[model samples]
Target: MHITLIVPTNGRPSLVSRLLAHLERQTLHPDHVIVSATTPNDIEVRPDISFKVSYVFGDPGLCAQRNRAMALCDGTTDIISFFDDDFVPCDSYLETLSRVFREHPVYAVVTGDLLADGAQGPGLGFDEAVAMLDAYRPSSLPAHVRDHPGAYGCNMSIRAQVIGDLRFDERLPLYGWQEDIDFTSQLRAHGRIVNIGQLWGVHLGAKGGRVNGVRLGYSQIVNPIYLIGKGTMQRWFGIRLICRNLVANTLKSLRPEPYIDRRGRLKGNMIGFAHVLTRRADPEHILKL
Candidate 1:
């Protein structure tokens, strides 16, 4: 299968470097790897890498950058896989993905199990991440592959032929919250979207190169409402999401946790909820926050 990998990043060169190293050890390699950044110089490429690497630049939003990278793919590319710059895949990651797609012709999208920092908590160190990848192995069988509602943007792959000309919603703006659900939900019309437990990976959950807690918190509320208004999300689902985030942020803010901005997120969620109550909620308000 002719597969291409796309990673959209913003000033996270060191993390990208580690991801490249993991790619080198993959049992199945991509025909091409596209690294999309805010500027061409933000990425430093290693000439010793075996696969073909391409560096491209675009606006900083994740959705916009990914779309730019997808446009650069060769027309014949069969599958396009999206991986967050902070994700560290197991050695058999690509091999497992390729096998699922090859075996299930009707599968339109596959989302891998995204573990939190290799079973370690947040702020995962580089050496620890590499070590975890080195020692990883598949722990389950065919039962691991099952139907899912949507793809997880951190680690998901789509069949290029099946999702022709589709791109992420730029209106979702920075961090592009729920962009994965919005995009993958559209693909369900074409075929099944499944979660492959054996194709697991760890998300470093690095806080850098991301929007502030306020903006993310705003997205947590506004994005869902916007989708619901657009008919992309069910009203019940949107309400549940709003209530859950509000309650979590409210409760957690009284005593903030390490590596999390409980207070800031609570404030943002309250602001968004107020807007919604006043009938003035807008997704664009996230930028203003």
Candidate 2:
């Protein structure tokens, strides 16, 4: 199977370059890699890489950049994989994915198990991520696959047949919070969305390039509601999501963590609630904040 790796990145040229170097070590190398970014400076050009690497430009939103990369996949590409710039996959990551897709024809989308995710807490360093990957024994664990409602954005792949004209919704904007779930969940109608344990990776979640706390917080509240209304997200799930974020932010703001802007996020959540109450909440409004 010809797999194309699409990495959508912004404001992290060096990080993306590091990810490319790691990809070179993949047991089953990708047929092509398309790095999508907002501007030329967002990525450093690499002329010495052995594998095929293509760079594309687009608007500054995550969904927009991903859409730009997806446009580059041609007929020869059998699978399209999306990886965040900070994610580090085990050496056999791509190889295992190829095997799974080749053996099972039922799955349309696949997401890997994350050994560690720094996005939930303080970001992890590149060296730390490499150490974690080095410690992992790919052959030690038994392969496991199970049905999933959605795919995580950091390390997910979709069969080309299922992606036929489908695209990430650009309305989410900026960080495109929950855009992964919105995109992969819809593919369930075409085939199964499953999690493959052998396709594991580490998410460094480096904080260098991230949306501001206010914008991100607004997204935490508004994006779920917007997606629910659009029929892309479950109503109960969306409501619980909003409530969880709101409660967490509100309580954490009292003794905010040094790494997070809890107060600002709380303020944004309040703003989102106000807008929602007035029936004027829009995911695009985060751009104005």
Candidate 3:
């Protein structure tokens, strides 16, 4: 299978370089790798790597960058895999994906198990993530697969043919909150989206290139609702998601974590609610913030 890896990044040239180096070490290397960024400075190209690496500049947003990268895929490509700049996968990650896709023809999309996801808490350092991946060993157990509403953005792949005309929603803007869900929901009609345990990775969730807390918080509330209205997300799921983030941000603001800007997020959540009540909520508004 010819796999093309696409990584959309911003404001972290060194980190993107490091991820490219890791891709060189994959047991089954990608046939091609495309790094899409907002500006040339957002990535540092290294010609020394064995795998083919193509760097391109696009509008400054995750969804836009990803769409720009996808436009580069050619007829020979079988699978299109997306990885965040900070995600580090096991050496066999690509190999496992090939095996699963070959064995299960019903799956149109696949996301991996995350060994350590720093996005859930404080972010992890590159060295720490590398050490964690190095110490790990593949499970002897058979690969476990589960149905999912959407693939996780950090490490996911889709059959290129299934994505014939679909693209990331550009309105999601920076960080493209819940973009995976929105895109994968559209994909679900083509084939199944599954989580495969064997195709695992570590998401460092590096904090340096993230959107501001206010914008991200606003996205947390507004984007889900936007998706719900578009029929990409269930209304109940969207409401629960908003409530969970809003409540957590509000309560955490009272005694904020050192690594998180809880107060700023709470304020953004309030702003999102205000906009929603006035029928002015839009994911693109994050650009103004």
Query: Residue-wise lDDT of candidate 2 within 5-107, one digit each (tens)?
Result: 9999999999999999888889889999999998999998877778899999977999999999988899999899999999999999899899989998998
What RMSD, rounded to one decimal, does every model reach? 1.9, 1.2, 1.0
- Give per-residue CA lDDT, model 3, range 19-48, as digits (tens): 998887788999999999989999887878
TM-score of 3: 0.97
Q: Model 1 off-target regions past 4 Å? A: 117-121
* Per-residue error (Å), model 3, residue 260: 1.3
- Per-residue C-alpha lDDT of model 1 across residues 15-39, encoded as one tens digit per residue: 8877887788898888899998998
Task: Determine which window of 10 residues in candidate 1 has minimal summed lDDT.
Answer: 114-123
If candidate 3 were superposed on the true structure by all CA atoms, what would the RMSD be? 1.0
Prediction 2 TM-score vs. true:
0.97
Misplaced by over 4 Å in model 2 are: 138-141
CA-lDDT, candidates in order: 0.83, 0.91, 0.91
